[model samples]
Target: MKIVIIGAGAMGSLFGGRLAQAGEEVWLLDVWEEHVAAIRAHGLTLVDTAAETSIRLNATTQADAVGQADLVIIFVKAYATQAAARTAAGLLGPATTVLTLQNGLGNAETLAKVLGAERVAVGTTAMGATLLGPGRIKCGGHGPTHIGSFSGGATPRLHDIATIFTRAGIPTVVDNNANALVWGKLIINVGINAITALTGIPNGQVMANAETRELVRLAVAEAEAVARASGISLPAADYFDQVAAVAQATRDNRSSMLQDVTHRRRTEIDAINGAIVAAGQRLGIPTPVNETLTLLVKTLEKTYLV
Candidate 1:
């Protein structure tokens, strides 16, 4: 398949590199000129447990240069979803499938508004990667990726997309309840992200201490209540336990939120914890923890020069 990866950040590079390595026609598209230029010059350098290898692929900042694509996987930041989708219209063909494997909530909805709901899908991934530098990324963790139609149930395209992703070595599954999957991801991020971002600690570090663990649990509890009110049945009943397991699995790795803070970049707090707060208000569920965390993270962002 000819795929255009919009955003081309850490996760984008990893997925595009793996798919390209699997022999798909993959293009990495991003506004980061240094990253795109480096990929053009040296290929995309991927580091994993076994070895570090550079995977050759196409890349460009100008979407018009690529024309139409079979699939457009968006991995852009939550704030830039609309703008990025608007800028990449040249890459969308009539049959082009736009999949959002992005963090936070409402991303698929944003895509649906721009690309038409019929051509868009929602996805959540547990695969983790870190951008070491231009054209270089370290994929340190592997986990399942779930995808489904924006129309709310799994369809044939979900399986087809899952097949392509799995064939590229990204273990994937088709979720009939894509919104629930997204909520599950939001709960996980709500439980872990802001705490890690504020403390400058690895994911597992939160589980090591009672105080930190309690904070994570409370945050998660608030989100779980909101999820239930929204009528989304999460895959796991013990949501806090699931978050802990995820933190344990990716123990040493820093979260995307933490990385954003370290780089003084904006975070998806408004979409993660902030989303929960909005839902809580709309549904009459008080989400004090999520509300506070959202405020705190936004305050921290204010301190940054960027």
Candidate 2:
């Protein structure tokens, strides 16, 4: 399959490199010129728990250079979904499938607006990666990736994409409820992301600390209430325990939000916690904890962005 990864950041590079190694034709599209140049010149280096290997693939800063692809994976930041969708047009043919393994609730919707709804898919992944430098990334760990049609039903196309991903060594599953899958990942992000960014703590330490753990519990409770109000079924009956277990499993890792803060890049505060706050307001549910965390993270952004 001819694949184009939009973003080419940590996760994007890791997936693109793996697909390339699997002998699929892969191209990475990004706005980072130096990173593109580095990949074009030296290939993409992927470091995993097992070993480090470099895989050669096509990469460019321009979308037109990639032409149409069998699959387009949207891995850009949540705030850049619309922009990614705009660029993705060049990568889409009549039969192309656009899958967003992106974090947050509304990314698939944003893409569906620009691309046709029938062409979009929504899902989440547990795979973790860190950008080491231009053309290089460390795969922190691997986990299952779930995908579904944007319209909330599984299709043959969904299964086909899952097959392609699994063949490339990325475990994938097809889900019928897109909203539930997105919300399931959103719930975990809400409980962990903002608090860790605020405290400068790793996932395990954030849950291990008493005050932070309570904050996680309250924020997660509010998000769960909002999810219920929105008529979305959560992945787990006990979300707090689910979140705690995830924290313990990925304990040593710094969250994406924390990584963004430490690197002085903007975090996805608006998408994760802010999405819950917006839903809560529309549904008439109180989400003070999420709202507060949203404000604090935005405030934290201001401190560095200026």
Candidate 3:
């Protein structure tokens, strides 16, 4: 498959490297010039727990350079989805599939605005990554990845993509309700990301304190309420338990938001928690905890490395 990965950061590089190693024709397009240059010069370095490997693939800072692709996997921040789509439009063939492993809600809608819903797919991944340097990322927790059509159904194309991921060693599944899948991932991000970024703690450390755990719960509850209010059914019945389980499973990992803060890079706060706050406002669902967390993360972003 001719694949182009937008926003080749940690997760992007992780997937791109794996697919490239699996002998797929993969190109990584990102604004990270240094990373792109490093990958172009030395290949992408994927550091597993006890093993290290590199995959040579095409990479460029300009999306137009990639020509056309059979699939476009979006791994960018939610805030950059539309811009990435716009930049990537030149790379989309008539039958190209666009899927997002991005966190947060409304990514499908944003992508649909650019490429139309017929070409868009929504997805979430449990796979985690830590960027050590340009062209280098440590593969953290490996988890299931789910992809589905934006219209809440699966097509043969969706199953084909899932099979590709599974063959590359990343377990994947085709789901029906894309919104529910996005929200299921969003619920976990909403509860964990902002708090960890604020407190400078890992996922396990964040859940170790009772007060913080409740705070996570409250934030997730508000998000859950907003999801139900929007008439979206989430993946889990005891959603808070699912959040706690994620915290446990990926305990040692710092979330993407926390990684952004530590690196003094801009975060997807507006996309994750802030997206929840916007939905709550539109739906009249009170979300003080999420609102406060959003503000706190944004404030920290302003003050970081100043």
Candidate 4:
């Protein structure tokens, strides 16, 4: 199957490089001219805990290069989702599947509005990847990827994709309730990512600090209420345990939010915490903690941008 991966940063390059190395026809599309040029010249590099390898694949900066594909995996930032979807419209066929493995909520919904709901799938990846340089990614953590249809429909293609990842040594699972899984990840991110970003600390530090741990619990509790009000079943009591588990797994790793903050780039705070606040408003639930976090991040973003 022909596959196209939008945004060749970290996660996108890791997955695209693996698929290409596995002898699949994969194309990496990005707007970054320098990165695309580097990939086109020297191939994409994948640096993981196991080994560092490079795979030659078609990389382009033009969206028109995103021709018809059986699957299109979008890895753009949350704020750039619409633009990426619109550019990737050329890659859509009648049976094409568009899957988004983005963080937080509403990404699937946004893609569904651009592409049809029947053609859209949502997923969350626990795979940790950091951009080492142009056309290079350092993969750190190991975890399973979960994917499924967001419209509550069963698709055999999801299983096919999961099998492909499994063959490439990336564990994957297909679930009927991907939205719930996404919400679960959102709960964890709400608790962990922002705290790390604000404190400039790793997961271990946040979990080890008594005051920060309580603050994380408060944030997760608020996010849990928002999720429950929106008809999502997320038990708050077990949610903290899940957060602690992530802390243990990636103890020394900085979260994507913290990385973004350090790089002076915008964080996914809108799609993460801001999503909870929006959902709370729609469901008549209060999300003061999430609101406060979102506002603070936005304020910080403005300061850095200026």
Candidate 5:
């Protein structure tokens, strides 16, 4: 099946490269001109802990270059989701499946508004990646990716896509509760990512510091309350363990928020912490910790933007 991956950054490149290497028809689309040029001239480069590898794949800057595809994976930053979805409109066909594996909440809803719920799938991935250079990415951690229709139904095409990814060594699962899984992932991100950004530490360091660990727990608890109020059942106890496991697995790797801070780019603070706060407001739940963290990150953003 034809697949187009929007956002071609670390996670996008990692998945696109592997899928292309596995002989699937994959196109990597991004707005970064230089990265696209470099990939077009040479090939996408992947540097993992194991070894450095390269794969020849079609890469382009214009979204229209992707044409039509059987599947479209949106991997952009959460803030960029709406724009990406609009740009990807040119690539959607009658039977195309649009899947969003972005961080935080509300992405599927956004896509559903633009692309229709019947064609929308939402998911989460534990896969970790870092952009090393223009066309270079470091794949550092491995984890399962789950995809499912937002309306909680089965899609045979999704299963076919999962099988293709599985063949590329990325474990894939199809679940009916993908929205709950997304919330679970949001809980993990709200707890770990912002703390890492504020402290300029890796995930493990945040877990190692007693003060930070307590702060994370408080943030997670607040988010859990918000989730429950929204009628979402998160893997609460399992989510805590998953957070710890991710911290241990990516001990030396800085989080995406930390990377955003270092590069002076905008963090997904709104989508992460801000999402919790918004949900709380709607449900009359107090999310003080998440609100506090959201303000802190916005404060940091002002410093960088100024």
Candidate 6:
């Protein structure tokens, strides 16, 4: 399979490196010149519990250089989905499957608008990764990746992508309920991300403390309520408990939002908690906790340069 990774960030590097190692023709297309240059000079360095391995692959900033990919997996930030979709034009062949494993909501929709709904698919991945530097990433854990068509039901391409991803050591499942998969991940991020970003705490401390745990519960409850109102089929009924379990499982790790705030990079608050708040307003549901979290995170972002 010929694959093009759109963002080439931490998660993107992990999936692309593994797929390339599995003998797929993979190309990483990112605007980060240094990262692209490093991968072109030396191979992409992947670090895991087993060992650090340098995986050789194609990488370029110019999408025209890697024309017509079989699969284009979007790993860009949620806010940058529109831009990424526009940039994806060079890589879209007639049969190209554009899968968004991105965070939060509306990403797949944004892609659908530009690339056509029939070609776009929605999904989520449980694998975690962190960018160490140019051409280097630490994959914290491996987990199942779920994929499905945007309009619902299983497609042959979904199964084909799942097979390729699973064969490359990234276990993937073809789930027909795309809404459930996306909302399931969004609910987790809603609980952990903003709390960790504001408190400068790891996942363990977020749930371990009585006070912060309450905050997480309230925020998650708000998101769950909004999901219910929106008719999104959530994967589990007990979202707070699910979020707590995820935090406990990855106790020591810092959330992606925390990393963003720590580094003064823009966080994905608008897509995560903010998305819930927006939906709440649209559905006439009060999401005070999530709205407050969204406002607080936005305020934090405003102060990044101050």
Tens digits of per-residue lDDT, candidate 6, 34-123, equal 999999999999987779999999999998798898999999999999999998876788899899999999999999999999999999
Clashing pairs in 3: none
Residue runs of model 5 more than 4 Å from their true location after superposition: 236-238
The digit string of per-residue lDDT tens for model 3 on 60-158 reads 998767898999999888888889889768888889999888988778898899898899999888888889899999887777998899977889989
Cα RMSD for predicted model 3: 1.4
lDDT accuracy of residue 207 in candidate 6 = 86
lDDT (Cα) of model 2: 0.89
RMSD (Å) per prediction: 1.2, 1.3, 1.4, 1.8, 1.3, 1.4
TM-score of each: 0.97, 0.96, 0.96, 0.94, 0.96, 0.96
Task: Indicate whether candidate 3 or candidate 5 has the larger lDDT.
Answer: 3
* Least accurate 10 contiguous residues by lDDT in model 2: 245-254
Q: Which digits, one per residue and each the tens of the lDDT, describe model 5 over residues 1-306?
A: 788999888889999998998999999999899999999988999987778887899999877667898999999999999998897788988899999989888899999998888889998887888788899988867888888888897788889988998998778988878878899889989889999999998777878988998898889889888888898877556556678887877777778888889889988999999999998998899999999999999999999797
- Model 3 residue 184 lDDT score: 89
Query: lDDT by residue for model 2 over 1-306, one digit each (tens)?
Result: 899999998889989988998899999999999999999999999886778898999999989788999899999999999999999987789899999988887898899999999999998887777788899888765678899998878899889888888999999999988889999999999999999899988888867878998998999999999999888887789789978977876776778898899899998999999999999999999999999999999999999897
Models sorted by lDDT, best on top? 6, 1, 2, 3, 5, 4
Model 1 TM-score is 0.97
lDDT winner between candidates 1 and 3: 1
What is the lDDT, from 0 to 100, of the residue 255 in candidate 1?
Answer: 90
Candidate 1, clashing residue pairs? none
lDDT of 1 by residue, 1-306 (tens): 899999998999999999999899999989999999999999999998889999999999988788899889999999999987786566877788899989899888888888889888888888888888999998856788889888877777668878889999999998788788899998999998999998999887988989889999999999999999888888889888988888887787789999899989999999999999999999999999889989999999999955
Question: Which residue ranges in model 6 land beyond 4 Å of their true spot?
Answer: none
Single out the weakest 10-residue window by summed lDDT for candidate 6: 245-254
